[model samples]
Target: MIPVKILTSEEAERLGLKKPTKKSGFGIKGVGCVVQGKHGGEGKLMEEIILRENGDLELVFMDPEREKELKSRRQFTGYLKQFTKIPEGLK
Candidate 1:
């Protein structure tokens, strides 16, 4: 399973990610998780996985450089599983 890092609201804010909100399709009123992958010798931000109020998962990709490198959305997503941790519940 793909690994992920769950962020606290404060940490999310510190990272400059969009604030979790009930109104947003991606998140509820809680924090989201970060999905990182290896790139160019170090870990790079791949996407943010947010839990919707209805229990659906939302994926938000924030790295433009990785986007350019991968070209297609399918390739980008496939690459994310290469390095990361999946939370227990998600697993």
Candidate 2:
């Protein structure tokens, strides 16, 4: 019932989060924080689980921390003016 944001690499570093040896080769290792949640309950958590050759794996939430950084990458936004003309067939 709550909305949660992703984690950033910097926030994970300051929290003393380190790579887990036992879970190595499984995926990325780290935890993250969430901003807020529903009814003031526990917020969402973020963490890395595995890492692959192509850098694709599962990231899970283990614990939620407050005031942590958001996601690492920003969303892509195309230029509005450049999109003025639509394809003839599509319309």
Candidate 3:
């Protein structure tokens, strides 16, 4: 599965998802079924996601198109000094 960038509230609205509502009770918003758009999607499907209380969004990857179109920032997590000698002047 390819990584997709998380969308902001405003971004989601702009992308066609409904705006957040106070009355919308939530454990996980996008659940149960894969949101599919027929007619106008041009064969593309709408990916589902969960909106967390802290505004964290989780995308459920059911379709494979995301792998071809999505791009994520590459992050190096391992400690650099463990792999090489520490450089001087910046310590």
Candidate 4:
């Protein structure tokens, strides 16, 4: 596998990551959010259906394109840490 260049905070800032003005806020960037699930009211059909090897169905990410911004898994985790109290199941 190719080594990925991890972006420094300064580098991320140069790429349009504005420093959070709020106290206790994160100081990083290059992150995006994706959401997918039932919508248009309860019991509505999901937008995308994914069949897993375990035979479970999962919804397609609504913002897959946005998720491509992260360079590595660590970056993705850090980004989520900024806004989420991650559950043990997800961790």
Candidate 5:
């Protein structure tokens, strides 16, 4: 499982994730699942799995700076790696 990093308010601002935004219907919504947790502790370590509207599962991360660094080091092949596909029963 991928490790999770919960960004602090400062980190969120640095990553541009705290910017104000207008509502848009084209935005995709997903169900977030916590893959790990500690008893009686703030959720500092956990992976978030998002089941998107298109029936694709995604591991969520908040490090846009790291993503940009990685992208600059290599070419992004315009392909998304799907961890799980929707079940036939759900279709």
Candidate 6:
């Protein structure tokens, strides 16, 4: 399973990501996901996140070209912190 960075609303802003919404019914809002490739380049599956009250985080890892060329976006998401790290630029 691929790891995805989990940034708080403030952290996301520092990294130029979207902010969390105060009115969101979800417990976690205004979070951002960033996936970095092994070749020292950033991945393109950038998106903001909202964690439903009882939902979980998910992720997947694959070659970039394959990820893009793949016809469907049936991706898996998870909240593991192995492949992900708080980006140095944000820290």
Q: TM-score for model 5?
A: 0.29
lDDT of each: 0.56, 0.38, 0.44, 0.44, 0.49, 0.45
* Model 2 Cα lDDT, one tens digit per residue, 1-91: 9797666877766676755445665343442233456785885443323334334443333232321233222211221122223233322
Candidate 4, lDDT over the whole model: 0.44
Per-candidate TM vs. native? 0.30, 0.19, 0.29, 0.21, 0.29, 0.22
From the highest lDDT down, the ranking of the candidates is 1, 5, 6, 3, 4, 2
Clashes of 1: 4
Runs of candidate 3 with Cα error greater than 4 angstroms are 1-26, 29-43, 71-91
Q: List model 6 lDDT by residue over 1-91, tens digit each.
A: 9899888878888886664555355454334455445676766654333444435332333434533443255433222242233323222
CA shift of 35, model 3, Å: 7.8
lDDT of 6: 0.45
Worst 10 residues of 6 by lDDT: 82-91
- The residue ranges of model 4 lying beyond 4 angstroms of the native Cα positions read 1-62, 72-74, 85-91
Candidate 5: 10-residue stretch with minimal lDDT: 75-84
Tens digit per residue, CA lDDT, model 3, 1-91: 9998899888888987874676355455433224445676555553444555544454443354432333232222222222222223212
Clashes within 3 Å, all models in order:
4, 6, 0, 0, 0, 6
- Give the winner by lDDT: 1 or 4: 1
Best by lDDT: 1
How does residue 80 of candidate 4 score in lDDT? 43
Task: Say which prediction, candidate 2 or candidate 6, comes out ahead on lDDT.
Answer: 6
